[model samples]
Target: MERTGTEPVTARSALGLRLVLAAVYTPLFVLGAVVFSLWAASAGPGSVPSGDGLAVVAGVCAALAVLAAVDLVVVVRRRRRERGGRG
Candidate 1:
């Protein structure tokens, strides 16, 4: 479907906002993964089963990072297509 008048602008702006949020979250998620990985690695094998917990945290962070990256890519592609259409 084609966007009419201001609708395209609004949709583009929304995508830009989402891209910004994704950019902000990507680093945070990466940092969380790094921290969790370190904590998991440092934990003693015999120590309380915290490794599993840390692993879960790291996994979640990794997933978030992947999702954010995907979102960024999609938004950028959409913006490119929009711009290309206008030219």
Candidate 2:
């Protein structure tokens, strides 16, 4: 297979890796945020005291989710542009 670099690379093909990564991370981050947020909110029992550190974990998760979402949007926009305004 001789390489010539003119095989019509598509947006989906070009950005598949990053798209998959962003999609995966978005849910994971949201899940982490929800779980830690719940834990932080339910900090009114034994062992885990109130205002310990669950909130911080939740915050970080939320922040990561936001960042990942932003990345996802950027990737999607780039893909659309690559696709000649199909979005």
Candidate 3:
């Protein structure tokens, strides 16, 4: 169960936790945004959320997308750096 000191940590393993979390949470966030929009649309004008509410949803989705992109870039660069160092 324990990791031996002889084993080297690669970027994939190092980023695995964050990547998993991001993968799970990001989709849920986007789905929630979509559902919210659909519900708002179906509810008609009186029940619809304000423009600011829609803007907030857009902003959150955008931020999550940016974060995911940055995480991917960091993982890729780390993997490349690790490979370069090993060779």
Candidate 4:
């Protein structure tokens, strides 16, 4: 059967995608935070790590989180609109 735009994507599918992205990104972010924190803790009184590596990883994970959040918001809004129409 041919699919059309009128059909909504399932909530489980949307949530699964969001959760998968979150699961993948959360660890990377936490790892980067830990490494950066440890490096900072070990540094001299007036020094920080060069931080380039940590910054890159954190940036990537932050970007992924933002995208996932946007996707989740869109999915939730769509679901709400669908339900509102049905009532």
Candidate 4 lDDT tens digits, 1-87: 345666666523355566567566656665665666566455565354445554555566566656656665666666566578531
State the displacement of the C-alpha of residue 20, model 4, in Å, after optimal TM-score superposition. Answer: 8.2
lDDT of 3: 0.64
Q: Cα RMSD for candidate 2?
A: 5.5
**What residue pairs clash in candidate 2, if any at all?**
none
lDDT of 1 by residue, 1-87 (tens): 466676545553688799899889989999999999898999888767588888899999999999998888888888788788531
Q: What is the C-alpha RMSD of each candidate to the true structure, in Å?
A: 4.0, 5.5, 6.6, 6.3
Local distance difference test scores for all models = 0.84, 0.84, 0.64, 0.58
Rank by lDDT, highest first: 1, 2, 3, 4
Query: Which predicted model would earn the best TM-score?
Result: 1
lDDT value for candidate 2?
A: 0.84
Of the candidates numbered 1 and 4, which has the greater TM-score value?
1
TM-score for each predicted model, relative to the true structure: 0.77, 0.73, 0.50, 0.47
Q: Write the per-residue lDDT of candidate 3 for residues 27-59, one digit (tens) a residue.
A: 766776676555545555554575557656766
For all candidates, what are the clash counts? 0, 0, 0, 0
| lDDT, residue 55, model 4 | 57
Query: Can you list the residue pairs that collide in candidate 3?
Result: none
How well does candidate 2 score on lDDT at residue 11? 19
TM-score, predicted candidate 2 vs. hidden true structure? 0.73
